[model samples]
Target: MDLSIKGTNFLGYLPSQKGTQTFSTFSCRYQKSNEEVFHQITESELEIALEKASAASEKYALAPIEKRRNFLREIIALLEEHRTLLVQQFSKESSLSEDRGNVELARTQAQIQTYLDFISRKDWNLLHSQELNGVSFEKRLCPIGPVVVFGASNFPFAYSTVGGDVASALAAGNPVIYKANPFHAGLSEMVAGIVLQAAENNDLPDGVFSLVQGNDYWIGETLLKDERVKAVGFTGSVRGGEALLNYAKERKTPIPVFCEMGSLNPVFIFKDAFEGRTKEMVEKLSSAIKNDGGQFCTKPGLLFIEERGSEMFINAMRDEFTSAAAVPLLHPSIYNSFLKLSSVFDRFPVYRVEATAPEYSVYPQLTEMTAKEFSAFPAAKEEVFGPFSIIVKCADESEMKACFETIGGHLAASVWTDQSLSEEWMYLLSSRVGRIIKNGVSTGVAVIDSMHHGGNFPSTSDSRFTAVGKDAIYRFLQPVTLQNFKS
Candidate 1:
């Protein structure tokens, strides 16, 4: 398992560096540029890659399920064999700790295994056959052709190359074109190489998997506009997802863009809940805000509480922030954006912890405002993508319900209460989010069959589908019914 980094695009099984335009991934840990300079995939190369993927889709989709299962197994074995190297590169490129990198690597492997177990089942394709009035009809899931996946910056392994999107797409028998996130191009290339090796070892199609490297927006725009691309998977900011969605719309034939954009993930704490478990709730909330530098899409950005124990919760949170240490973001751009977005709280009442953080790091802060003030302040609702949260105080249950109505869709909304919530509250919360949590933080997403990782409207393009879990494969599959077909 002597894997080496080439810092070039993987056009199927072949490594390409035909483009002169190049960029280097920055080492967030060392605060310096990585040694390898990666060549961007040119328009001509992208076209070739798309052509190969389009051609390969037919064969890959029709290939035996055993071959696909073997492909996934090989990928898992390779990832495990080179786990240490992958974790090291992941840590170097993303500035995340080695332990976090290992966790993400294991998660990535587990995600692939989930898909593997799904496709290995007898009912994997959801096939159905019925005969009525001397007519026979059969229906089953079919691949949607080539899919383009945009890697995310935060989780270099689990959400980036060889991540959930690629795994589910491949498992569903769809060819995948992975666009490497420029911030972690080197690590992405390394993982891409592993996937390509697995494809080659399993004798998969030439264009079954491809990696395109570039930072320019046009690279993604070009991939989205091509007719060969049947679907897309994206994980990033709202602005980036909007751009890709618009690009897909501009295409003569629109395609499904399954994007998991960031969310506010609000937490509602009832008076009783707050007063009863003030210390415990504060600890959980603080950990949620500070974990992974608050880079998770499900990080609780909004905290709603009744005015009765609002002061106590605020005082506890203030102490927690002051004692907490700061952590570095994925990149400088993200760090700058965090600073800019969190600055909106300067006009409001805010408490920030002062820490001598490293370069590209941010301190934890808690901002406060009344429900009336929150409603009046539009900017306060916007997600500040770091270890920052806003506490909204409400006069009573009515005011709290009114405030909840104003919030748009979110990935998940948590309710902390000892007793059951009202039907009205339950309905409102369930309607506004894809997942509802009780007495728990929304930071950790379980990669199980029942997990729904997407949300309504702005949280995701389609709430009906999830970006995680076995159901994610449905995004790359469509149903085809055969009439009067004889087996």
Candidate 2:
């Protein structure tokens, strides 16, 4: 595998550099701009890619499932083959540790393997046959045509180019036009190159996959406005997702937009749980908050605890935050956003921990507030996308429940209790969140058959579908019923 980064857009298999507008990715580790200059995809270049994808969608969709599976298999093999170089580039571009990079890369490969396993099953097509009044009918899943995937900035390998969205879209037989996140454009380009290689090796259609590189908002807007695009897959801030959703709605023929947006995943701690395992819970929560500098969307941004034993837990958390070392975020823009959002906590009682760290690095912070104060302050609910969390001290169980009610939809909410929670409590928590964690942290998301990484409203555009795991492929597929049809 050639591990060179060519700062060009992959318009199908061809590398084109027609656009004069250019940008460069920053090195968070070096605290400076990278040397390579990347070309942005112009409207004309984007139109060509869209046309190719539109032209090849049917061919790719109609291709044998085994062929698609083989393409995915090749991608997995290529990813593993280039793991060392890819991890190096990932760490260099994102300023994340090499271990984190390797872990994310492995997760990316595992995600593809999960899809491969799904497609290999006998009932992979989800075929349902029925007979009524001597009439035969069969229902099966079909591709939704070319899909536009907007890469996420946080998880460069797991959610960016050649990530779950791209893998699931390809598995569902939909041609993908991947819009590379400019934060890690070089890494995205390398991953795109690997996917294109796999497609070529499998004798796939020319437009089965395309990569568009650009930092401008119009690039994504133009992709969403195209009538040929059947659906969209996005993972980013709520604002970014909403913008794409609006663009899709404004189109003459609206398409489904599966967006995995930000969430304020809250953790509720009962008196018994805190008292029984105070030290253990403190370590777990601190680790969750400080993991990857708390850049994950599922990072616990809020913690609800009863006021009786809240002081000890708060002090323990403060101690943990104070001792922790700071780390650089993925980009300057992300660091800037984190600083701006976290400043909102200054109005309330805030305990911050800072270390002697390099540029673009941020320390962990903890903010304290009462349930009533939290409800009164609308900004308290907003997600501060860094190692920052708000601790809400509730007077009683009812107050804690009320705090949960004030929160909008989230990806997950955790309950730390030694005893079983009431039916009412469970029902309310389940209704408000997509996933409920018991006696655990909300940072690590499991990619499995039953995993639900999506949530209601602002957490995701469509709660019906997920953006992770094997079920994610269903987002790019629609059902078709055949009546008395023969092969």
Candidate 3:
């Protein structure tokens, strides 16, 4: 296994050995053609990586703000320089579409560029002071200690090794130790390599960044328990996020954990809205369900459709959802999860069931249930994490209200309404979701400053911070105040 840390240096360590060669192993296997081993980054390597990160934090924090800005700029330039290699590796490992891979590669560069642009503003860390007689106080943002970032499985580029968390932490002047997501471990290593080279070229300390490739929970646990790690950032399933949270809390000095877990992002369609915009909703939603194999955290997995006027819309959706051939999921676990959750949905009295005609052919599956059933069972609201959606027929406004009460915290929601919404309905939905799409699909998340990619409990650890957009940098920054100090 190859581990990268503290510059462009590499360490070769065996996963497990006997006597003097004893070492732990962490292997990542991707599902492309045949399952092939991606990489193994050992425990000893991870310890050394953290040590270097801690050492780097002192210099990185005190380094001129301009140097950090230049470091970020160098990363963006290097990403652009190796755009082809990144896109190729991302596609080859994840089996995502070539054009999509290229777009993601661009998005990665853009994410870093967003941080760079924000960091260059210089006001991010500015101090404000007020003098009263002989007393004066000034406050400014300071970098939290080295941060541990857990990457995303579905989004290797935008949310993985070089994802928003890593970018935001660096932008705020914190050293980042990225735990590579197993689904794209190879890409993570490559991105780490690029950052190390770029950091060395920019004369930044090696401790500013480190990447360790491992698929085990213990790796995350180890990092969370490390006293030197002041904060952690994560994006993945609820179980994974919660495990990291638990690890953090169990530590003697618990640290802050910012986790963005998956959610059952739901879309509600009013009858009047259904009457005027059924076609638009159907087209927009069908693409959302199929795109990225429905692996997105904000994918509209549940729909609250009006009972009276949704027959045509539902029929159109069924055809659209089932017509497309299923692309392979990121791994076999996701595929099996789709199968298991299919059985779970079957346990309920389904209004409709549509899947690819062949048994083992593809992954897209659509199931329907009444509003009453959807509210009755907790499992119905749980995230399936694949190309699966449940349609809940809402007979009236009251049922929709009841449905909203059952909804857990979500990253986003959509209300496709042509007519005015009652204040009650607006209030009900607004309190439960972060980003609300007005009459549009909830899938496409733009990487702009105005976007808020977070939500309430169960959806994310903190609603105040976002995983994407400009506000994300704050997660890695703390504030300090100096009294009676001179400029």
Model 3 agreement with the true structure over 121-231: per-residue lDDT tens digits: 757676586777878877888999899988887888999877899999988888888887766666776788777777777778867887766566677888999999999
Tell me the lDDT of candidate 1. Answer: 0.89
Error of 3 at 255 (Å): 1.2
Q: Scored by Cα lDDT, where does model 3 land?
A: 0.77
Clashing pairs in 2: none
Give lDDT: candidate 1, residue 359.
83
lDDT of each: 0.89, 0.89, 0.77
In model 1, which range of ten residues has the least summed lDDT? 349-358
TM-score, each model? 0.97, 0.98, 0.91
Candidate 1 lDDT tens digits, 39-119? 999998998899999999999998889999999999999999988888888888888899999888889999999999999
Error of 1 at 288 (Å): 0.7
Query: RMSDs, each prediction?
Result: 1.3, 1.2, 4.0
The deviation in Å at residue 132 for candidate 2 is 1.8
Once superposed on the true structure, which residue ranges of model 3 sit more than 4 Å away at CA?
A: 1-39, 347-361
